[model samples]
Target: MANPKRYTDDCALGPFSTKSQKTLSYIFSPTLWTPLLFLLMAAPPSPSSVSAELRTSGEEAVPTEVIGTLGGFMTLPLNISVGTEIEHVAWNGPQKTLALASPAGAVIILDKSYQSRLSISSQSYSLNISKLTPKDEGLYRAQINRKNSNITIEERFVLHIYEQLQKPRVTVKHTMSESTSCNLTLVCSVERAEKSVLYSWTWVDTHSFKSFESSTLTISWMPCDPDVAYTCTAKNPVSQSTSSPIHAQQFCADLRASRGRTVGETVVGTLGESVTLSLTVPVSRDIEKVVWMFNTSIISKDWREPAIAGPLMKSKEPGKDRVWVSDQDYTLKISQLKMEDTGPYNAYLCLNTPRLTSTQHFTLRVYRRLKKPEITWIPGPSDDSICRVTLMCSVEDSGDDVTYRWTFLQKGAVASQEGSLLNVSWRSSEYHPNFTCTAMNPISNSSWQFLSGNICPGPSRSMKHWIILFLITVVLLCFGFSGWCIWKQKRQCSAPAFNSSQVEAPADLSGQDASSSEERQFIHSVLLCTETPTGGTTTATE
Candidate 1:
């Protein structure tokens, strides 16, 4: 007691610390405390603990809700490895129960009413259930433990049971129009989940077909005809089900009305241009195949014939409406549009129905257009003098409606007259060869505007002689006028001198002397006339 009073605050093991004391207590009570601590550390975490911890997949523990598929998974923190193995998995209630063990492969299944125990290895731990029943529904719990770590996972799955399934319902998804094609889809679904279902598809016709899927039916093509129907039926071993009359009748009426194929729609196009017609046939019965016939001839006939342009015929099936169908829109384009090309045509298709046909009428009119005429020169006069340049105008295209006019241009004057011929005096020097004639008709007119080639003389030889005669006649008239003027002047000079001498002698003498003198003067004048040469030309001396 006296030695304890000397104790220092710096003692190796202080009295205030509980670490060493707690360690000593654990060592002394190993039998009771060791097992409790091990249990505490190895116990599966509670749902609250798992939920409260915020974690990412790689950084924290794996959640129990997300159990890996059939394969084993490695969780985070590799030091704490955990996995499970089981021989079989079974269900006991509305939800299934699962139990598994680690490494040892020991397995046990417990339902509300049944419990089973088994051992399994990793290779044989997975169990597959093909069909699920109401009794299979139960809670599923799997436990895995390794070393000091353990994991427990729970999954809840509900199983549904069905009584019987109704047949699938189908309806037209697209509207019916002559110019357009429509599509249809059938939906087959049951209100309750069923383990096994048998599905079959059939039409109003005698044909039968089937489907592998649950209870859905579909028809891609539907026509506006009124005699075809589509039907579907579904069944199981315990019970058989069919679609309701309301839903069935709706599709039935739609398909039933689609009896004839459309084959092709009415089409119009320009002359010399072609058009393709599409033909559709709606049939209540199954179609073997489609055969096409143009008019009375087979499709193999030559397309060059006019009959190919005619209406085609389609033979109908035994139970369907007559189908007149054409791949072409009842169209025939003429190589050249002619009045005869216009007519009625038939487009026909060969369907299950007997003979069905459609007709289209085409009216073709051809127009006649005027073409320009060709011209050639006719042979006539050639050359300026001895040969005259004569332009012979004629039309290459002679017709009843044609008319002609002639025109001439010379010496700064323009004169036009109607005829096929024109004549002008030839001038060798300074002459213009601008002659032209035009031919016209009520419909068209053409001029020889560019016909001015070489203005050479044509084939005439009489023009030179006619011009020479005209020159000779003018020269003769000029010489005759000069001779007449000289004769008239000599007679005037001789008469004036004789008249003056007679007047002076008559006043001075008696009547005898006057008479003798007048007689002598008259005698001398007569003698002068007598002595003058008869043929000699005379000149007046004044």
Candidate 2:
């Protein structure tokens, strides 16, 4: 009886007073008990008591790929930290296991093929393979695990081992078309590399560049197209090599050749300009060296001629750094050409890679462009009876190859003359003439029409002089007419005006009869007064 409430709490499932459970039915309801039972059964244990979970998947992770050179050593990277506790690690090659290591035990390599070459680092646990070969290229797997755990992390790698790519060799095959054109098939390949190597080509010519991919490249051109140079590149995954630029020209030469050389070439040069020789001898060989000569004399920057021109062949032309020989071909270039540079030039080429010898010979002609011709005339004295004038047509720069032509126009007809001089003569009554001068050279020409005064005295000049006189006379006549008009105006202004209506008779005659003698006398006097020169109107008796 003394501890009834405490006893009832001990008997209840919850620590609540009877007043807290306002509805007794709800306090012991089955719906509340069902949910509480299900929640306890559905949930697992808390984090403090959980265990490590092991995961394994196949081909889920993307593999890392790397390049390796043949006969070179490469290590498979281990991404684990330096402080990572490594209980064990294993490496699997393309076909079998290669290496295995344990922190607590000695490293074991199961594969006999890689036993001598395989190695493992204890600190980083990275596996290194030495003396790599082509057969070693394939997928590799690394298995890594921590201490006291069955969990394993795998890393896959793809090894692409390749040999060192050396300088490639290019072989050329020639084909001819029905016309003058031809085709060249150039095959580029490396001898020391694997079959996985790729090839590409580069073709260079005047003002153009072209490229192609493949071990085989086909090139062709017309007779008018310029010679093109080509080079090839061979590359593998780990190494690259490029061939030397092809130096011979016979494969693309449009001109016929004899003994691998083209002869009888010509090149033109303008005065104060540069000139390059045209020598296209396509060949399938490597250029060793090129020697250029001018007029059977060797051409170099410092040229020396022999004292006595007997049997020894040497260059006599003064090079003075003016000549440049192409490294890729047998062509020669001369800068700032002079008039005396007009001569024959010979080029000798020596090539290897199947061994070849070629030559190129050409002539260079230097010319000065013609300047505009000018016509100047010397007029004779006006008092001379015979009209004679000298016309001279000349140019600033004259050359031996230059020529002159003259065209003369007289009256309504035209005439042509040669030479730079013209002696013109015409009488005073003859027609004046106009003329033109043209200067020409082998390369260019210039013409100038004479625009000066009449070359000789004739009716045209006389007519011009007469026109001047006529204009002067007309001006004088205009001045005389203007003066006469001014004089007439002044005479009118000085004279007096006259009116006849106001004339009257004298007062003495006013009383006289209309027929009186005095009236008649006054009338006569008034008329007489009016006749007076400088007087007011005369008064008369009315």
Candidate 3:
């Protein structure tokens, strides 16, 4: 076992009590003095003082201290002998040769070939162990056989060695998140690394971009356009690493639009017929989006993704000064027009200006056809008489303008003025004929009545006389009855014959009878004359 004392411990003097000192003195008094005398007798002549000498070994050597005494004065010798043997050994002149053994049992020969006079007795010694490596890790033993005394000592040395770690590596990759429009993340990591690592991140921060750093390297980013270089560097105490060039890219979605067009007014046809509606709109200039709508409902809006055969065709190009657009005007041909279709129609135009748009409206009208009139004869005394007969004419709804004409289809064959009724008097024409009245307008016309029905014959001479006689008799009877009634009323109220005494007329009974007979004879002759007819035909003009 090596010495248990630590290198940092302080060297202490030996513990000695008075009683133990006396015992040690008695033991060493005579018998031990002989060995001491021998040691002294064999000792070389001592010099005044010895200078310090450094030992030649490698850096593995340890510090050493030597002591020597001489000539009863205890002077350290300058010239001395040092070797593995601490017994009686002699030194020749000034030159010194020291022999020692390493802890690993190797013989080492140390020669002091050059020297002057060694003076200092106590030499503070250190070995040059820097050139000596760890494989010589053992005690090195050295002894000094000096002129005064002999001594030997050994030193133990321990060696340690170490090696540094290697540098780390960095790998970078780019990725994005759910929000595609957001900034991307550039993640850099130390791949297959053995040591603890650190990282830093930097990006091309233009007007809109930024950068950050993490342990190895992780990065969160935002949207910014950059035209400069973005670089990332990773470093350790051992080595530094940089990344390869990364190219950044971007993309966006295409813009979509709606077609701007409108349908206009319609033309109303008559009942049970169709009407044509013309839609008016300007053309499309560029590659336009077309959406077809009815009222507010969207019929079809995607012209690019047409459900049927493509609904949108190319419009005329806008060349030079002339402006060209798609044919947005459409004529809607409506079949089977109804009465309800006559009111109004609207066309909505969604045109594309720079920003603002426009719309339009229109109207339609329908009307009914006119109907002809009807005429009927009023039955009266003239129904069968040869005199004029009245006929009534009326028209159905003929709007504002209706023309009426009464035509005598008989021998007259003349058209009369327009009225509700027309009178025709029968005359002894060459032949009997038919009469008709026509009611006409621009749209339509119709005859009032045909004369195809039974005809009314003219009155005979006998019939005329009978009529006159009947009239005369009716007048006479009426007058007589009136006179009788007056006379009876007077008689009932007062005297029967007015008490004939009051009425004194010229006794004229026979005169009155004669006047009455004369008047009766005159009426009879007038009646007979009226009954006889003249030979020539006579037509009354009124």
RMSD of each: 24.2, 27.8, 37.9
lDDT of 2 by residue, 253-369 (tens): 312222233247767789888888866756665655554544424432212221221111323565345656554454566677788677666555545554544666776778898
Best by TM-score: 2
By TM-score rank, best first, the candidates go 2, 1, 3
Candidate 3 accuracy as TM-score: 0.23
| lDDT against the true structure, each candidate | 0.38, 0.63, 0.38
Distance from true location, Cα of 511 in model 3, Å: 92
lDDT score of residue 146 within candidate 1: 23
Candidate 3 lDDT tens digits, 1-542: 11222232122111212323344454357976788678657874233111212221222234322211111111212233343223322212112333333333343434443122222222322232322222322222223332333222223222221112233233444454553222334555556443434566565555555455663434443222222344555554334565644323221100001112223553435544555555455655331233222222222222243311111221133222111112444333334444443443333333345432233444445434545577676543444324455667777655434567776646642333446566555643324446666776544577755563455553345678889999999999999999999897655545414433422332334455444565445434433433436654422121
Each model's backbone clash number:
67, 14, 18
Deviation (Å) of 173 in candidate 1: 25
Query: Tens-digit lDDT track for model 1 on 83-183?
Result: 32332322222233333333444545433233322223344333333233344432222222223322222222222234444544543353444532334
Every model's TM-score = 0.23, 0.39, 0.23
Of the two candidates 2 and 3, the one with more favorable lDDT, higher being better, is 2
